[model samples]
Target chain A: AQTVTQSQPEMSVQEAETVTLSCTYDTSESDYYLFWYKQPPSRQMILVIRQEAYKQQNATENRFSVNFQKAAKSFSLKISDSQLGDAAMYFCAYKIPGNQFYFGTGTSLTVIP
Target chain B: DAGVTQSPTHLIKTRGQQVTLRCSPKSGHDTVSWYQQALGQGPQFIFQYYEEEERQRGNFPDRFSGHQFPNYSSELNVNALLLGDSALYLCASSLLEGRNSPLHFGNGTRLTVT
Candidate 1:
């Protein structure tokens, strides 16, 4: 079974600064997908960004990017120019060819103004 | 376009009871997946429904069941609920054809068991 781990339970970043949330997973599948999801206090889960294991180049979307190290089974999310809106529970997820999705314990991100 | 939508934003049930939560998939989506997010933990996959059939399931027990309609809407049913079942239930929809289809999630139903 695949499992995702987010070591940091809580993180804080000053406004306009950058922050990185660490994530690691255990999976034997050669090809898979990694994703970072943000769940605000309202309880709505929103997709931040995603990375494909086969892609060597890290995926970036605006201020959100991922540092994906397939060999180390590490996929970290980086948020630049952090804003107050970034405060939420961030989760790292893993999925393979199958349909099931495995998620990490989550990291609560607090944007300090 | 409308994203995934779930019904009964909140619910309360007692032990030995049954609860049913509904979900409407996003436009043009044909697959619906259900997840249970316990407090302080991540969302755990319950099952995935495609073509009105259960295409895949996780390690959840048989007490957890679901149904998918022809319109791609889905429902998650839990029987003999326990206090452990108190959590947020999320519904996600995605395209089945894409190798890496991103799941659009709903606001989720907060279930409270007593």
Candidate 2:
């Protein structure tokens, strides 16, 4: 069985600042994947970024990026130059060797002006 | 191009009654998966459909059933709905069941079992 954990239930960041959301997971497989999903107030789940276990390079998509530490079993999402639109519930997810996705409890982010 | 699309943005049903939600996979996608997101929790996988067959399932009860059409569309039916069943039902589409595939989600249907 695989499990994902997002320690912070809530987070806040000032506009144009950087914020990091922490996440950890427990999995038996060596080869897997990690992801960060953003769900805004509209309740639409959007993929922010993804990382593969084999790749040491972190995934970056504009202001959204992930610091994936395979040995530590930690995958954290960093939002740089945060804007009001970045305020949403962010979920950290884990995909096993296969594509079975497991999500964390989620972190609700608030971008303050 | 159309992403994963689901029907009935919102629905309300009484207890013990049944409800059905529909979903159409993204263009060129062959796999459809269902997920249930409760209040203050992450989305949990209900099941996955590939080639019109159920390939995998979660820990949900038998009361939750689904059907995938040949056209790659799908429907999720929940029998004897309970208040706990109320949540945002999300439909996702992936190319194949592997690490390389990423799921594209729909807006989700907010089902309220009152």
Candidate 3:
């Protein structure tokens, strides 16, 4: 079974600052995908970024990027120039090609203004 | 395009009662998956349906069952519900083709079993 672990329960970042949320997973499969999802108070889970395990290069989407270290089984999300709107619960997820997704406990982010 | 949508945004049920949650897949999507997210916890996969059949399921017991309609809409049925069954139920839709196809999620239905 694959399991994702998010060590941080809560995180805070000042406006215009940057913050990195850490995540690690245990999986023996060589082919997989990693993702970061954001859920605001509205309760909608939005995709932030995703990384393919086979790709050595990291994935970035606007201010959101992922530092994916396949060898270490570590996938972290970095939010650059954070804004108040970034305040939400972030979850790290892992998925195999055709299997169910495994998600971390999540980290509540507070964007300090 | 209309994303995945779930009905009864909020539902309250008592112990031993049965409840049903519905989900409509996103436009052009043929696969639907259901998840349960407890308070302060991550979402746990309940099951996935494709071609109107269950393709994968999590560790949930037989008390949790589901069905997928011809239109790719799905329904999750929980019987003999317990207080621990109270959680936010999310419905996600995605293409069943490739590995990296991302899942489109609905706002989720909050289920409260008292």
Candidate 4:
């Protein structure tokens, strides 16, 4: 079984500032996928970004990016120019082949004005 | 394009009662997945269905079952509900085996098992 861990339970960042959420995972599979999802107060889950294990280059999407260190089994999300809308619960997920998903406990992010 | 959708935005059930939740996949998506999100927790994968068959399932018990229709819409059935079964159930859709095909999610069905 694969398990994802988010050591930080909560985080805060001033608006327009930057923040990073840490994530670690345990897996024996050689190929897999990692993702970061955000759930706002409305309770809707939204995909923030994703990374493929086979790729060496980290994935970046505008204000969001990931530092994926496969050998260390770490995948962390970085949010730049954080906005109030970025305040939410952030999740780190693991997906091995066969399409099964494992999620971390999550980190609650708060963007302060 | 319309995104994934789930019905019964909210539901209330008692112990031993049965409940059915529905989902419609995003247009052009053939695979649908279900997840259970307990309050203050991340979503846990419940199962995945494709082409009217269950392709994979998570650690959930047999009481949690699902079915996929030809149109790629899906249903999640839970029997003998327990307090532990209370959650916000989410439905996600993706293209089968497409590299980097991320799953888009619905708002979710909030089930409160009393």
Task: Using DockQ, give the best candidate's number.
Answer: 3
lDDT tens digits by residue: candidate 4, B1-108: 898888999999999999999999999999999999888888888999999999988889999999999999999999999999999999999888786688889999
**Candidate 2, CAPRI quality class derived from DockQ:** medium
DockQ of 2: 0.74
lDDT of 3 at A57: 96
lDDT of 4 at B49: 97
Model 2 chain A scores worst on lDDT over the 10 consecutive residues at A92-101
**Model 1 lDDT per residue over A71-104, tens place:** 9999999999999999999999998865678999
lDDT tens readout by residue for model 3, A62-104: 9999999888999999999999999999999999998899999
Give the Å shift of residue B1 in candidate 3.
Answer: 1.2
Q: Model 1: what is its DockQ?
A: 0.83
Instruction: Give residue B61's lDDT in candidate 3 (0 to 100).
Output: 97
Query: What TM-score, to 2 decimals, does candidate 4 have?
Result: 0.96
Tens-digit lDDT track for model 1 on B1-114? 998999999999999899999999999999999999999999999999999999999889999999999999999999999999999999999998777888899999999999
- TM-score of structure candidate 2: 0.98
Superposed on all Cα atoms, model 3 deviates from the true structure by an RMSD in Å of 0.6
Badly placed stretches (over 4 Å) of model 1 are none
Model 1 chain A scores worst on lDDT over the 10 consecutive residues at A93-102
Q: Can you tell me which runs of candidate 2 are displaced by over 4 Å?
A: none
- Model 4 lDDT at residue B112: 97
What's the residue-level lDDT of A16 in candidate 3?
100
Give me the displacement of residue B7 in model 2, in angstroms: 0.9
